[model samples]
Target: MTREINPFGLRMPPELRELLKREARLNGRSLNAELVARLRTGSDPPDANDPPPRGMRLRTTAVQPRNGWVPTDAERAMLTVFRKLPPEKQLALLTLFE
Candidate 1:
């Protein structure tokens, strides 16, 4: 069975947000995932030498079939958020991601 987590609103300094974003990128995680992990671990992030847990994003090669990959629950939630964006905002986000 799927566990439901309630959505939360967070307000933080822009610098802290950027720091988390950078850490998320380095750790191959979404920002929310990184934050949750940090919170659960009492602020110490996982060691950089450790292997990323399963379902963590990995860089793909030409031999991999990207389209055949399944989306993670976090990705699905983000997609839902994306879908709710205004058309121009959606396009802008698409451009940003691309």
Candidate 2:
């Protein structure tokens, strides 16, 4: 089945457009096709190995405790729950919480 699309204009850097075009070719899809898939899936932007117009990579850094940091009421409740968990589970939870 075919989908109907309306043409639209967007303004971006010329370099970015060129990159998208390169990427579209590498993926064996037209620029419009790649754009449609990206919009439909709501996936993260392409990586460096992907065609050039890749946006920035998603960044996540582990939380670190600061000096004199104090846990709030919510955190205390979470800590109580953590206590109920086994040691291995506690470590895993800490990894996410820390």
Candidate 3:
């Protein structure tokens, strides 16, 4: 049986919303369906049977610095926020920094 979906209002920047709309159109999905699909996949663990995409590999553990350096308060706070993001968004941010 399928669970019922409750409607909720969300506010986002206009540019972000437009980006989502464009993605939805490109993917042949409605805006609502695109958002729902993204939300569902955001929290789902990767399937073991699926191979990693080219240029990307999944790591079982996070890498540590050679010197075991400590993070500042601001860096720690940023890390906390980063950890709360969805995996795709995290990857996007990391790619941006790279």
Candidate 4:
């Protein structure tokens, strides 16, 4: 069986073309196959040695404090300041912790 592929032409910078060619060779795929796979996935394929995404890594290490755990004075002060922030400001500050 054959899949119908529409013919399309693209003009890219020489550097980008070379990059795609190199990546295709590294992955043992034809240039057309590499381009098609990337288009389907909407991004480059993940490398096995790459670190997990930031959010995933953060969630994995997150720990829930014991029921008896209490915040230190510094933590309490920080929380107090955080609570005083406006909703938008609070969200912006929270992203910094991420």
Candidate 5:
């Protein structure tokens, strides 16, 4: 089945356009697809390479822990679960972020 297309024009500051363009490139999406996806989600985009391919290059990025860093709610929740894992499992899981 073919979905009908709706054409719309948008106007925004040059900076915002650049942000969207960069996000689109990083996400491996066309600008229109990126915009539509964000609008549908009704939330901000994730970090520049958050999940790796779509955000951060996880395995390659350095861990630059801030001087007084704190985990976000999601990170805290993950830590709560991590604390329950057996020693072997904890080490295995940490390998992914290594």
Candidate 6:
């Protein structure tokens, strides 16, 4: 069953929205429906649950030098505020611009 998620307001660019709609249609679903499906499935979707039929697992890792970056007061405040938000909210903030 679907429920009212945002009763007040949310915003997105018209062109981007149209592009998303077109892509969703090409894949046989609505944008909202696709998002809801992914959300309900958690971080990894259903298809990723089992070992591959080929019995080979693909893995990747990136190694980076540890150069500690000191946080400014503003950065620290923002991190504190951001950490307080729910995972969904954090993901929303991360994706909202991109």
Most lDDT-accurate candidate: 3
Error of 2 at 29 (Å): 0.6
At residue 20, what lDDT does model 3 achieve?
Answer: 84
Question: Candidate 1 has which clashing residue pairs, if any?
Answer: none
In model 1, where is the ten-residue run with the lowest total lDDT?
53-62
For model 6, residues 1-98, the per-residue Cα lDDT tens digits are 35656643448899977765754554457887654544564565334324221111222222232454445899668757866775446556656656
Candidate 3: segments with Cα more than 4 A from true spot: 1-4, 48-98
User: Which residues of candidate 6, in runs, are more than 4 Å off?
Assistant: 3-9, 37-42, 45-98
Determine which window of 10 residues in candidate 3 has minimal summed lDDT.
51-60
Q: What's the TM-score of each model vs. the native?
A: 0.41, 0.39, 0.44, 0.40, 0.43, 0.33
Give the alpha carbon lDDT tens digit for every residue of 1-98 in model 2: 44575678889899988877765665567988877766754666433233222231222333344454655999668646755775446445545755
Give lDDT tens digits, candidate 1, residues 26-75.
Answer: 55689998887767765554443343332233323223333565568997
Q: What is the C-alpha lDDT of each candidate?
A: 0.61, 0.56, 0.64, 0.58, 0.62, 0.51
Sequence-dependent TM-score of model 4: 0.40
What local lDDT score does residue 41 receive in model 4, on the 0 to 100 scale?
Answer: 53
Candidate 1 structure lDDT: 0.61
Clashes of each: 0, 1, 0, 0, 5, 0
Q: What would the C-alpha RMSD of candidate 4 be, to one decimal place?
A: 14.8
**Pairing residues by index, what is the TM-score of model 6?**
0.33
How far is 91's C-alpha from truth in model 3 (Å)? 21
Q: Is candidate 3 or candidate 5 better by lDDT?
A: 3
Model 3 scores a C-alpha lDDT of 0.64
Worst 10 residues of 6 by lDDT: 51-60
Candidate 1 local Cα displacement, residue 70, angstroms: 44
Distance (Å) between predicted and true CA of 16, model 4? 0.2
